[model samples]
Target: MKTLTIFTPAYNRAYCLGKCYESLLRQTNQEFIWLIIDDGSTDETGKLVDSWVKEQKIEIQYYYQENQGMHGAHNKAYQLIETDLNMCIDSDDYLADGAVEKIIHFWQKNGNKDVSGIIGLDADQHQRVIGTRMPAQIKRSTLFNLYNKYGVTGDKKLVYRTELTNKYPYPIFQDEKYVGLAFKYYKLDQEYEMLLLDEVLCHVEYLEDGSTHNMINQYRKNPKGFAFYRKELMKLPYAGQLFKFRQAIHFVSSSLMMRNQYFLKESPKKGLTLLAIPFGLLLYVYILFKSRTVKHV
Candidate 1:
């Protein structure tokens, strides 16, 4: 069986998908499959993958599906990948040279049934480290604690055991919103610890068209996305009401501080920041003013 399956959910990313394909072709080891989910691309992405399939001498499977969100494509990838280990490499992002070889070797050396998965570092398109390193040891980590305690950020840098991930497929919601896959991975942490590879294996590019860079408007307009995340967080075991309430405050406060429209949309509906109603809007406004002052100063 293939040891790894690397896939991307791409929509109209034909121009950039080649970079991902090229990186896979350069791998020092080839115990993997590249599955590209052509998430209803109207562009020539199908032709692009076909061309790459002809030129590249690796295991490549290109599957197309109706445009689901990124999480939807991920749901499909998890269902289709028949491998022990799997990862989702964004079409705009590519792996570091020989990074997979290193990851596979690390897994060979350290992982077993007891360990759930492996986490790696993320770097920007220019290969600069994007987030902090994984902790040397994570004691009592939950999904939120991974971010809150271990300081692990960025939804992209982790790899998972296919069996465990497939078991917990990302859920679809009533509207077009869902909790992030990172939350799902964190929930998995309740059962297993991820082996930290401490290496920058993927180069995450910030494309103008990419979801992270451009989805603010959609998320703002729909707003249900934020509700989806809040609901998921509250559902966690021991996600106590007090803790949830406190988290709700922090979340909206942070969003207001950042002027993230999604949270701005959420703040009123969920009454998330209004627990301290008299000063809540003032606090948000103050934060915004302070940020602007700091930036200008």
Candidate 2:
């Protein structure tokens, strides 16, 4: 069995998938398998992957499912991964040099049943670290504390224990495709801390169609998914009042977008949701405006 499975949830990204495949080929260690969850891509993605499978340079597993946004693809990936450890490298991204070797060495030395997984850095194409680096002194921290308490920023690569990840499967809402991936990570935070690795594991490029760039559209198109994510965050016992309030505000806005008559009833923090109504109304208006602008462009 491989020590790690690098899964890519791709949707119509055939042009750039090659870069990710080539990066895997360059790995100093081939101890990981590449798992591609084809989330109903309509392009030449399937053909391209088939060619790679024929080359047989490394282990690859590919599965195709009806379109289900990023989080839905994640749900499928978690179901299929049998490796002891796993990590997600976006379709528009690739692994850094020696990344496989680094993950293997670090896990062998520090990995145990107690830790959820390893948290590593993600760099840009020019090798600049995204957001901020993990604090050097901290060896183990929950994903939430790494940001909320210690102030680590930017995009980071998470390599999770497959067993642990499977325990918190991301929920799939019908007709919605944009649940926050952190839903599962935050759940894991309740039980285990991840070991921090300062080395860069993945290099990312934010294509225009990528989720991060089109969040406003996501907000409008997937209000129920957003509402569910915010409600989950609000229920986190470790979350501070301010964080919960922020989630409440967004929850209210999404609920409104959904035209859900039970907004207040469904809220985890009804008092906070009531107080945030005005701000949420403003957010709803802004989403409408922004979505209109996107359509015009």
Candidate 3:
């Protein structure tokens, strides 16, 4: 079996996909397979991938599905991967030189029965670390504590044991509000602490229309985003009413920014939690004012 399976969920990224493909082809380590899940792009992505598959230069598996969003594409990757370990590189992302070789070697040397997989680093398109760091060693529970206390700070540049990643099919919460594939890593952390490699391997392009840039729209249009998170919050131990209150406020502001008046329109049902809005709004304003003051100063 291949040591690693790298998959990219792409949509209308024909321009960048070639760069990603070229990087994988040049990997010093040929111990990995590539699975490209086209997230229903209207572009010529299918044709490009078809050309690559026909050439068969490397082990590339491609699948086309209706656009169900990133979460849906990830769900498919989890199901289809058949390697010992799996990692995801975004469509607009590529790996660094010899990065895959280093990752495969690290996994072979350190990954074993006790460890689930390895966590690497994420960089910008120019190969700058985008902020993902974890301790060398940590118990699963402690990791969750860190996440709950400070929120998830790092890019989850994680590779998971294929078996573990497939345990929970991507959660398609109401209205498809799953937060990408976060719960997958969170759950794996429950059992195994991933081996950390303090090296940048993947470079993600922060395009204007990328998913990361659409937080406001997602919060506004996907009312279920709050509901899904509410469920996850309940699953955490120390997430109290205060925590939920803060989150509710954040969601409200994000919705308003996206021109989504869900909180106002659904006040009777969804706005019972509006009680937290006043404090939330005050905090938001304070932050904005502080930011402006700092700029002037």
Candidate 4:
């Protein structure tokens, strides 16, 4: 069995998928499988992947499903991955040179059942680290604490044990396509800490169509998903009052957008949600205003 599955969730990204494929082709180690979860791409992605599959430079698996947004694709990837370890490299992102080799070697040296898997850094296309590096003194951390406690910023590449990832499936809401991916990670943090690797494993490029660039529109269009994510965050034991309140504010705004009558009743922290009404109302109006001008590609 392969030691790792580097999965990519692509949607109408045929133009950029070749760069991702080229990076995988250049991997120094072939101990990993490339799994592509095609989230309803109408482009030539299927044909491109088929051609690459025939070349057989590395193991490749492809699955095509209805467009379910990034989080939905993540759910599908986690369910399909049977490898010992797995990592998500976005369609616009690619693995660093020798990244697979580094991951396998680090895991063999320190991987254990007590931990979920490894957490590594992500670099930009210019090869600059995107955020702060893991502290030298800390060798392990829960995904939540790493950012909340240590003040780490920006996105990091997470390699998870396939078995553990399967246990926490991201919730799929009807007519909603976005959810905080941290929903599953925070739940896992309750049970296991992940080993931290200082190595950079993936190179990221945020395109115009990427989710990060269209969050305001996402908040407006995916209110239910946002509300559900906020409710989940509110229930987290490790989450501080400020964090929970912030989630509550978003929850209220999203609930308003959805016009859910039982917003208060459904909230884990009803009192906080009630207290956040004014701020949430303002945010709701802001989202509406911003979304009107924003074009979701």
Candidate 5:
């Protein structure tokens, strides 16, 4: 069996998905499986993937699901994955050359049951590292501490063990599509730290239609999902009180947007949630205003 499964959650990305596919074909190490989670694409993505599958170049698995947003697609991928390790390479992004080799050798040398997986780097189109590099001194850190305690910045690639990724299945809210992806990462942080691999693994380009580009619209439209995510973060035992308070602020904002009256009662930190009410109200108003003029990604 291959050591790693590189999964991509795609949503109508036929235009750029080929770039991701081409990058995989260029991999120096072919001991990885490419699993594409087709999140109900209306475009030519399925046909394109079929063409690649017909060529029989690399191992590929494609699963089609009704439009369930990114988190639902992720839930399905975790269920489908059987490899020892897996990491998401978004449809619009592609892996760096020899990244599979780097991860395999690094994990073979450094990995153990004690660690969750590897945390690698992501570069921009011009090959610049997307945020500050991982802290040089540390060999491993939880996803939360890497940013909050160590002052590391930017989006980093995360490779997780299949077992762990399967545990925290993100909830699909009634009509909402987004749940903060970090909810699962922070949950895993409570149990394990990820090995820091400083090499760039994937190159990312945030297109206009991507979720990162439309966070505010997502927040406005998916308040229940956001509220659920924020509440879970507030319960993290390893996280600092300040972090919990911040989550409470967002929880309050999302709850208000959803018109959930039991928000204070539902919060893990009721005191913090109460204190956050005024700020949350203001935030809700700001989001409502922003939604009037902005378009959803």
Candidate 6:
């Protein structure tokens, strides 16, 4: 069995997925399986993967589902992954030249049950590290602390254990197609600290057509999903008061958007949510104003 499963949750990205496929073929270590979750794309993505599957140049398992947003695709991927280790390489992203070799080599030498998985670097197409490299001094830490406590910034690559990833499933809200991916990571942070691998694993591209708030629109539309995600963060034992307050602020904003009168009662941090209400209202208003501005522009 392969040591790593590289899963891509694709939604109508047939145009760019070829690059990801080509990169996997270029891997220095061919010891990984590629799983593609086809999230109800009305594109030629399926036919494209079918052609590649016939070539047998690499292992590819493709599954199609009704459009479930990113988190829904993630839910399906976790269920289907058979490997002990897994990583999400976005449809618009691809592995670095020797990413598979680096991941397997480092994991085999250092991986254990106590650790969730490895946190690696992500670079752009130009090969510049996305945000900041992992702190060399810290050998292990939760994904939350890596950003909140250690001041690590930008996007990084995450390779998680299949067992742990499966434990926290992102809930599907009615008519809502989006949820923050960090929902699962923070849940796992409660029990595990990931091993740090400062090597670049995947290269990412942020397409202009990808988001709503910038995907800000995602928040305006998926209020239930956003409110649920923020409330969960408020309950994290490892997070700071300030962080929780910030989450509360967003929670209130999303809840108000939800038009759910029982938001305060449903909140995990009631007092904080109360304090955040005024600010949340302001944010809610700003989102409305900006959304109109976008439509006009």
Best by TM-score: 2
Worst ten in a row by lDDT for model 6: 208-217
Model 5, residue pairs in steric clash: none
Question: Lowest summed-lDDT stretch of 10 residues in model 4?
Answer: 288-297
| TM of each candidate vs. truth | 0.79, 0.99, 0.78, 0.98, 0.98, 0.98
User: Per-residue alpha-carbon lDDT of model 1 for 1-297, expressed as tens digits?
Assistant: 889989889989988888888899889999999999988899999998898789769988999998777888988898898999998899899988988898899889888888677778789867678767666775324445667656677744777889888766676655563346666775787688667676888998888767665444344433345545554564566455665665465456445434566654554336544563334455456655655554475
Prediction-by-prediction clash tally: 1, 1, 0, 0, 0, 6
Off by more than 4 A, model 6: none
Model 1's lDDT to the true fold?
A: 0.72
Question: Root-mean-square deviation of each candidate, in angstroms?
Answer: 5.8, 0.7, 5.9, 1.2, 1.2, 1.0
* Residue pairs that clash (backbone atoms under 3 angstroms), model 2: 131-154
- For candidate 5, the 10 contiguous residues with the lowest summed lDDT are 288-297
Local accuracy of candidate 4 as per-residue lDDT tens digits, 1-297? 888999999999999999999999899999999999999999999999999999989999999999998999999999899899999999999889999999999999999999999999999999999989998889999999999998888799999999999876787888889988989999999999999999999999999999988999899889889998999999999889999999999999999999998999999999999999999999999999888878542
TM-score, candidate 1, is: 0.79
lDDT of 3 at 82: 91
Model 4 misplacement above 4 A:
none
- The candidate, 2 or 5, that scores higher on TM-score is 2
Predicted structure 2: lDDT: 0.95
Off by over 4 Å in 2: none
Model 6 per-residue lDDT at 292: 76
Q: Pick the lDDT winner.
A: 2
Q: What is the lDDT of residue 78 in candidate 4?
A: 90
lDDT of 6: 0.92
